[model samples]
Target: MHSFFRDSPEFEQRKRRPYSPPKVTLAQVRSAIPKHLFEKNTAKGCFYVARDIVCAVVVYKLGWAIDPFASTFGIVSVAVKWFLWVVYWYAQGIILTGWWCMAHEAGHGTLSNQNWINHVVGFLMHTFLLTPFYAWRVSHHAHHKATMSVERDENYVPRTRKDCGLPDELAAKLSDYHEIFEDAPIYTLLRIAVMQVFGWPMYLFTNAMGSPRHPPYTNHFLPWSSIFKPQHCNYILISDAAIGAMGYVLYLWTCQVGFAYFVKLYLIPFLCVNHWIVMLTYLHHCDPTVPYFRRKQWSFLRGASSTVDRPFLGWAGRFFLHNVSHDHLSHHLFSSIPFYNQPLVTEHIKKVLKENYNYDSTNSFRALYRTFTECCFIEDDGDIVFYKNKNGKTARVLADDALDAPSLH
Candidate 1:
C-alpha cells in the first residue's frame, strides 16, 4: 500500500481486484529466502531476551533512584520529579514492550528451533506481561495461517455493512454521507480511548473484536471457549494458572513496596505495553485497502501478504520493539524467521511477491486515526472484501455481482 488511506471517488469505480492464487508456492517462497536466515538461533534468541531483561532492570533502578535526588533538590524539586517519573515510565514501558516482542517471537517459534525452549521462554515472558501464552499462542498461530480471512482470522474482524445497520447499497455520493449515517467524532474518540486502555484484556476475556463466527463470550482463558479445541484444554489450564500466579506475585510486590510504588513500577508500563500492542496489531491488518478473503478466494500466500508492514517508532521501534512491525509481511509468511533475519527474508520475499508486499511508513498516529474512522464495515457479500467507512463509502470497490466473487463458505 503506497498510502494507508485513499479519498478518491475513482476507487469506487476502479474496484480493486481480488488476489488470484500466487504464481509461486509456499515452498517457492521459502526457497527464495537465504537458508541462513531461516536458522532458529537459540543462543541469539536468549541473548535478546537477556538484553531486554537487563534494560528493564536498569530502567527500574533508574526510576527508584529518582526519588532521593528529587527530595534533595531545591525549588524545582516537584517539577523535576514529575518529569523524571514520566521519562522513567516511557523508558520502562518501551523496554517492557521489547520483552513482548521477544515473547511473540517465541510464540511463533522464531526464538528457537527447540520447541520446549520456545515454550518456556514464551510462557515466562508473556506471564510477566499478564498474558496467557499458550492460549494466545493457539489463536495467534491460527491467525498466521489465515491472516486476512474474514471467517478464520483470530482478531479485529470487520463487521459487514448489514451488521453495521447500514444499507446494502453503496452510498450514492461520498459527499452525502453526513445525512446517511451517524457520524459522531466524540463517540469514536470515546471508543478509541477505551480500546487503547482495555482492548487487549477485553479481547482475552470476551473475544472482543474476534471473528464473528465464534460464539458470544468466547474467550482465551477457557479451553472450551470456541477458540480452543479439546486437545488444547490442558494448555489452557496451564496458561490460566500462570496468569493467576503472576497476579499473586504482583499483589505480594504491592504489599512489600506499597501500592503506589507498584503502580508506578508495573501498572503504568503495563498500560503502555497494551496501547502499543493494540496499535501494532490494529494498524497491521485493519485498513481500507486491506482485503479479507473467503474460503475459495483465500490461499496461504494471499492471506499472509495481504496485510501492511509499518515502521513504528523508527529506530527506537526496531531497537526496543524487535522490528516486529517493520517486517510483519515476511513474518506472517514465515513465522519461524526471527526479527533480526527478517530483513533478508523480507527483501527476498518482496522480490517473489512483487506488488503483493505492502510497506507503509505513515506516521502510526495518523495511520491509526485514518484506519479507525475510514475502515469500518465491508459489504456483506463478496469472497474478497475491502472495508467501507462509517459513511458507507468504500476506499476501494470490488464487483457487486455475487457471481464474480462467489462465497466459498
Candidate 2:
C-alpha cells in the first residue's frame, strides 16, 4: 500500500516541477477546448433533469413495494428487509444526487443560456433538496473566484497552526504540533465521523469553513450576513423563503407518514446526498500535497491549479454525479461549460497544464479519510504552503527553484 500521505509514484512522475503558481492564462485555457462544448443545450439539459426525476420516482415506488411483497418468498427475515432498505436508500440517494448536480449546473449558467430559465430550475431542484439555491449560487460563485486562497476561499479552508492553538515555541523547536489530546488516533476518528455526518449542515447554517473576515456566526440564510451585500438581500430572502416552504412540506409529509417510515423513505437518502456532496467538495480542494495560496500571491489560474481531479465512485460517479469531482479542474477553469462537455475540456486542460494538473486516483472513501487526518494545518504565514500533518511534516516538498518572490504579487 502507498504511504498514507500518498507519496505515490504516479504523483511524483506527473509533477516533475515543484509547486508554483500556474503559468497558463485564462485565455489559453479557453482556447484549448473546442468551441462547441461551450454551447448550452437547454433541451438536452431538461432531458437529464427529467430522467433523474423519473428514476427517483421508480426507485421510491419499487422500494415501498418490497415490504408488502416480501411475504411472497415465504416470510422474509428482518435482516433481509433491512438489507433491502439499505439498497433502496443507496439507489434513491444516487438518483437524487444526479438531479442535484443538474441544479448545480444551472447555478453555473450551464444548464441553459437563458438566465431566467436556469434560475427557475435551480431554485426548484435545490429547494426539493432543502438547499437555498440563490444563497448557495452566490456563495459558490465566491468560492470559485477565490478557491485555494487562504484569506478568501469560502469552504474547507485549512486550519492554520495559530488557528489550532499550536504553541509557536514548540512548533519552531520540533516542527510538530502534536498536542497530547488532539493528535490521538481516537480523536482523529471522532473528528472524521463528526465531520462526515454534520459538516454540510454545519457549514450551511454557520458558515463553518467560510472566510474569517466575516463577522462571527455568519450564515447562508441571513440576507444581512457579511457574505452578502445589501443589493443581494432580496435574492437571499427569496432563497430563505424557498427553504422554509420546502421544510414545511417535509414536516407535513413526516406527520402524515410517521417518523420511522419517513426516515426510511426520505431522510436516509437525503442524508446520503449530504454526505456525497460534502465529500465531493471537500476532497477536491483538501489534500496533503495541494497548496493553499495567500491572497498576495493569488491569481485565478493559480487558485484553480491547486485543485485535484479525483475519480470518485468510478462509473457510478460519472453517471450519477455528472463528473463533478472527476473533471473538477476543468469545471474550475471553465465553469460555464456544461458537465456533459467537461471530459473533452479536461483532456485538453491536462495537456495544457501538464505538471500543474493534479489527478489523484486514490479510492475516494479512503482518500477522504487520508485527507481528514493528514491535511491538518498550514503555517500561520507563507505565500504558498502545503498542509502539514500532526507531526508537522508535508507529504510533498517545495523545490528551491519553485519559490517565487513574495514581492511578485
Best-performing candidate as measured by TM-score: 2
| Candidate 1 Cα lDDT to native | 0.81
Error of 2 at 229 (Å): 0.7
Error of 2 at 356 (Å): 0.7
Superposed model 1: Cα runs more than 4 Å off: 1-22, 170-182, 398-409
lDDT of 2 by residue, 1-409 (tens): 6665564555556445466555667788778888999999999888877887888999999887877766555555566778789899988888888778889999998988889889988899889998899889888999999988999988888888888777773535353454522457787777877777677888888988777777767899999888888988999999999899988999999899799888999898988888888888999999877788886777788788778898788898888889999899999988989899998899999888888889988767778877887887888988888888777778777767555634121
Tens-place lDDT per residue, model 1, 26-124, is: 788888888888888889988988999999998898889888889777898999998899998888888888888889988888888899988899899
| Off by more than 4 A, model 2 | 1-9, 12-17, 169-176, 180-186, 405-409
Assess every candidate by TM-score: 0.90, 0.93
Query: Among these predicted structures, which one has the highest lDDT?
Result: 2
